[model samples]
Target: MSLLDACGAGSSSPATAGGGTTAVLNMPFLEDMQVPDPDIMYEGEGVQVMHAVYDGLAQYKPGTNEPVPLLAESWEISTDQLTYTFKLRPNVKFHDGTIADAASWVAGFKRRAAINQGPAYMVAGIKEAVAKDPTTLVVHLKTPNNAFLHYLACPWHPFAVSPTAVRKHAVGGDLAQKWLQTHDAGTGAYTIKEFVPGNYYLLEKFPGYWGGDVAYDQIRITITPSVSTQELQLQQGQFDVITKGLPIPDVLKYQKNPDYEVPVTLGGTGNAIWINPNKPMFADRKLRQALVQAIDRTPVVQTSYGGLVPVQKGFWIDKLFPPNLDPISDTFDTAPLQALVAKLPDKNVDLAWGADGGAPVQQMAELVQTQLAAVGLNVTVRQLPTAQVFDLANQPQAKRPDLFIDWLGGDALHLDTVLRIMLRTGAKPLNLFSFTYPELDKLMDEAILQPTTDKMNAMYVEATKFVMDQAIFVPLCSQPFPIIARNYLTGIVQDSDLPEVIYADKIGRKLS
Candidate 1:
């Protein structure tokens, strides 16, 4: 059967229009989103929606790490790099018609800190956030952090919330958390029109948005868990775009098809096998090293990902690492691993992949299981929901899986995020195993404080080398996220800094 026939094209009304001021774009997600609250969401799926409905003080330039003026028109850093003063953009209004000013930004920062949820650490370094004037915001950090702007540009960065909305909706001092679940208080180009968890989310263009031109009048995202169903829908004109969940084979087919536009770009995301050090089986450093050496990543990348993803050479993504640094070699003798596995009282190891990962992730997990099994270890593969996989960090050592394969990346392209978020002691959710290295953490802490990029890169290189030696994680493959959209859709550029997320406001229907 042809690939189109295999996808099972079904009949449905088109979700996109060729031309009109009231253009609508329909997209699908394979996973359910958490609450739409900006301060609380840390997942990739939710970030895509939040990015559309919220604007930060600064935003990264599309396809680059450089932070550009967004809500904040401009900013200046103090000589010590500990203080930042931002000049707020004028006449910007939140979706609720409240003015987005310095005071509102300060309130938002305070709210984020007070709530202290998943992505709060992005602003934890700030000692104080004060509005010097209606249009001026002065922030004081405990120490100098050159990457502070990049942090603000991150997808999970704290965003400006409408203080007016907060006050009106505050119930028992929840900071509008309950109201924000199905609502928006942001100053972005889009506003949340409807939110139904595990079903559908609707976003409509804000009429009062300060940002120049709003694109699609409405963004309709439905939760379609099945990739095959999504494929069928996309072919049948039910889904204008399939942002995630389509398997690599189907994606490649879309790339060849004339009716679809498949744009592929590096997602700034990569998968890694995280070893739970707290587990008795992985407690020994030698066993960790043995496991790392036993499994080859080439087959995993080529077979599971169809050679679309490159095998990770180091802990950091290719862009963040210094060019001169030597790549981590995959060549290792498996004899030691085989011997170690044979000696273990319990050779059985539990391996898990995040549920959101879909087919590619499961295939990678199964391949790894086979590789480890070949070295005498009995590996059991399990699929856990993303939230449960994240919960493993807080679970008792006995309750956690021996090893879990998960996507390890950051909202920004900075090495600080790559190291800090995935390996830092307190960075939760993504830091699945709660892996901590005082030396590595110290290096990262120092790296961010460096006055120059070269100095920071040098420090990060040392930290990467240290982590490689420790074998806390088995570096897997990094793949470019593919977005398959109808041919008429325009402005579907992927933000390099925000991995897998596109600027919803920039997307417009192509003129007929």
Candidate 2:
């Protein structure tokens, strides 16, 4: 994805209300988000909520866009690349007045790894976790995993977990996952004061926070449906800060006005329509290539992003991904691209196009239909429920659908988030969304267990090639962070890589 400085929103939205000091920005789609507990959050939206009222061993800095130590002060990894020792910060207490120790962290992780117990079972890639000392935590790997650090930064990992409260709450049935689906227990800077599902949540700073002090004393987060509601509420002075989901160009027009501050934070949240290769029609490389060439990305980029973000290059970080993203890098190799599209066997293809029952998705689906049809392949745009998109992608072979239109992203934990969701065979389908390819697994193993620089690149290359060969997911575009905040909402730092809610500790009010 192109950096934020490169893409530009057409204009910023105007602010409303008598007290412009009380900024209200909007994020529509919170109703689809369910953050029942610290462990179980509504994917990306959950990350925002987790940032405000929760703390992990490592915390993200909104301004610097870095993850600093929150619970764990310092740590070490063996040169052999197997044993990882983590030393916890002492005297950290949860809102419930329970002290967090190494054992607590270990137990918390183990419980999280339980079947459906924690949202991060994927993070527990290895077989086991152990706490050797009160201040130290160790994870023995069945194989060396260098990307584990990135996994640790994930909100669902050990950093935000609390063992004592989790275990106590999880006595009868499988409690950890259940507790996480309902409760919040962590040693973060803030604690949940009140939680009314589908309504709003209030958070108060934790006085016992080991860190000097949190800048914000209170955080008020209310749920808003639809993107328009987020914008409407913010305009009405009902919000302090909001993120523009996927950067609709019309939304950016507000930035043209000087009344409200419109900051474009270069976030890692990318927007792309991933095509599943497992489908019989996508099974043909020709059809896949034809499809890529068929759909003109210009309209989506112009209409959806308003010329702010750029067309995405590859799956991983733009340059961080293998193959230098040189200027001509965006150019498509039509030979291979075309050859794949022509090779598809005559068969019915159902590309899972969950058209939000809207014109854009429907239009895009029509374009794709026409493009593939040109190559003598029949394409069925199966309009499905949004929720089934990911499930179908991750479903097992027999039950899986032919294709899915989906978006996956990464922040500081770029490789982990992308690779795990894209490759990690351990997930439901064994190969994430893509059906398993042996060569793909070998390369991933080399990157994970072998740990060689050149080999790592080779694996990524091989993996991308494998993805291209299968035509599983076709890349589309990236999204930019459009932020709106109040004047008194000082210390508001938006980390492009992480979520917006991390500002909980840094946010403060300035009474003029």
Candidate 3:
């Protein structure tokens, strides 16, 4: 059977009109080197390269969080929702001419579990993955999770590789991980033609790809360390696509230019003030509530975000969440904060943040410092690398900060990802807040099992409200993610399930 016949085609982007030509899609890179192994890739550049060269069981529908079948034609969830059976697309072959089947998936999952690197968290819930038959793949989970399918759709995890090719290239039992860094393997639309770490990489379209047509024959990604250089390149028409790192201020400057199309989209990730309850002053729920209420978000949103992003109404970004889930009203009041602050012996706050969130986090922290001062709180701001802040929080209880301004990159499709990563007991080590409540944990677990959307939303609402009452953290603004494209570039999908990712396969130059 043909590849398309094996795996039923899910959806196809509209073919470019007229006649198309080979176009160069230039992308950016922040890291010095991309981890070539898909199971271990966590950085943005690595993810981009992996998605370009690999296909997961599923992928998010373009511009939406809804999961759609990709390598797997369809999947069935058991009554308990712990077992997922996937029907493989039969004709799918990796770039190396090896068939990708249920066995390939099993091998990939086992490899991911064995490698145990940055993206290891993606498969942490899986109890086992087995090939029930040649085309049938069954994955058994430790517990029922509604979002497990969405997890499979994520670019970071469970993409099938050419196990035969991988094994052939394996050295010292490394599963070809070391070799894959400089090579390509998978059934993605593009194959790596050339790779130079910290410099650039080139992708050529795979002719045997079953995912309809790929507009661009080739994609060249250049390493850009500065946003200014990206902006300059965009203005000079040196690059067709700029994949992130250009600031909002620079995006604003290019908004009026006819040469570029600056798309301002709401990202799935959220920024917030993570309060550490282990600290003496913040241990008081009243004090935490007061701090949130006292701070005015208007100026922070206006100045820090340049009024580009919305002042978050609730913890979740509005685009990805149901409207009813947001708080009815977020009121700013100082009386409660003033009274609470007057009673506290220690009013000094150490605000720590990383460069990941860039100027917005720093500006938001400074604004918060000023806001709390009006209520008799003294704030000291500190800046550190992203790694150090997470390291300190993950260390012993005594090492956590009083408060940290940071961004939470939530799963775009489900709220459970946020709750599981930030609020659950085991998540305390990774989260800024070190406290866990039994009642909240119960609500979270129950919400996971809810069979209906209404019931699930109700439980989630209750859980969110419970967290709001505790005031463990303050939800700030959603980051403004703007994509800059040359006006001649066509077939660019501005919205994506993963806010940080932009698929390179769909890009095509406008046919004239």
Candidate 4:
């Protein structure tokens, strides 16, 4: 299939350019705009900007999940799969006009490791990145990591940054974190023209882009935090595309217009309510199972999400790597759950979540509260902004909520990422739930080090079943990213791997 076909982009809407030159995208909320640096960002909105402003050693091909040549012209893996050698594309230059060579990449990798921030785990396995020669970059791994390429292809990893730029901006060996928070460093399709945290940002096409011509000369990203406001702006012809965060009802309303197409695809983290087993309330397996059994996902999917999203019965890993070994049954039975509830001395519990997932999470949490209450359990829902929720999650065990309704979307397509980052005992500090499952931890370690895909798949399958049996978290649904694009827009490709990010490099207007 062609790239557009792979991206699922050919709709029947009549084509005509609304804006003569600029293509505008509207996002409901931005976690922050400190996007010039990749190490600190955890949100997918940051990834969207990274896709436009930086070039990785390798990247997933546009519209597909397969890794293709990006900064590296070609690459070879060692027989043991512990070593990688990449051949850099010749004549590439960073936005600062410095040559991007093997040494450039080596400097970036070392700097990223030193900073040891949010995405450092991606390259943490790398023992060293050496400059064998001007065009040759060699990487030595601590172990055989099956997901190495997928990690590099993810936006969270360290992309090629100009060594000269970093040196010039450094103060007290800070690695230019302050300057890069709002500046450009790599060779990408677009350059940062303007950035203003939560308000809006503008990007201009870089004529010197090594890949090729970028479709949009300028991309203006406006932060419209209200679903209603974004829908109105889209209708008023102010936005060429309304990005994710539009409520499902608003998305459904816009689908009726032949002038627009709301493309919905499975993306981001699978939605779930995390149970801190450390808490006394959720300490019992039966009690945790009871909470899961009480939730009827039918209304949450149909009424809240308008059926745009699918019910996620299996772990998110099942969506990508699956024979779906031991998929968690979605069958709801409240009898055992009620019996367990009767045994508890205190039935009052707190359900914490954010308003970030749009209307679906809010409605689901409310519905869960009402349903659980029907079974003679008192549930209190605590709502917080996205940042504050994360803050609470990182707090001490005593202060954390009983449960947090959120999604733990691995940044890449590998099961190792999902297992190690989210499921492995003591892995997720952000969630602040210190869980100790020695056997499960051993299984996860073996899964990542397994040299073969078949063996790796088997281990991950067993791990998924173990996690579900424990009822550590209640799996909800796989998030469906909704995009409303103007009918005239062509070359709109959503990355199959990084579905949260939308590519504008190939986006252009269609002639009627």
Give the candidate number with the greatest lDDT: 1
Q: Which stretches of candidate 3 lie over 4 Å from their true place?
A: 1-23, 32-34, 43-45, 171-173, 181-184, 193-197, 326-328, 339-348, 376-378, 382-401, 428-435
Per-residue lDDT, model 3, residue 79, is: 88
CA displacement after TM-score superposition, residue 124 of candidate 3 (Å): 4.0
Clashes per candidate, residues 3 or more apart or on different chains? 0, 30, 0, 0
Q: What are the TM-scores, per candidate, against the unseen true structure?
A: 0.93, 0.80, 0.85, 0.90
Model 1, range 1-512, lDDT digits (tens) per residue?
43433332211112323334356677888888889888898887778899889989887777666789888899999999999999998889988887888889888888888888878877889999998988999999999998789889878888988999998998999988999989999888789999999899998889898877765778888988888898877776667787765678888888899878888776567777888887888899998988888778888878877777777776666655643573767676689899988888988899988877778888889988888888888889999976787677688777788988877677676778888878888677667777878898899999999998788878877887788788888877676678888776777877775456888877765553
Ranking by TM-score: 1, 4, 3, 2
- lDDT for 383 in candidate 4 is 76
Better of 2 and 4 by TM-score: 4
Candidate 4, residues 456-486, lDDT tens digits: the string is 8888888877887788888777777778886
Clashing pairs in 3: none
Residue ranges of candidate 2 with Cα displaced over 4 Å: 1-29, 59-68, 116-132, 215-217, 319-386, 393-403, 410-412, 424-426, 429-434
| Candidate 3 global CA lDDT score | 0.73
lDDT of 2 at 296: 54
Residue-level lDDT of model 3, residues 136-224, one tens digit each, is 99999887777787677765657888899888999999999988888877899999999888788888889998676787677777777
What range of 10 consecutive residues in model 2 has the weakest lDDT sum? 4-13
Clash list (residue pairs), candidate 1: none
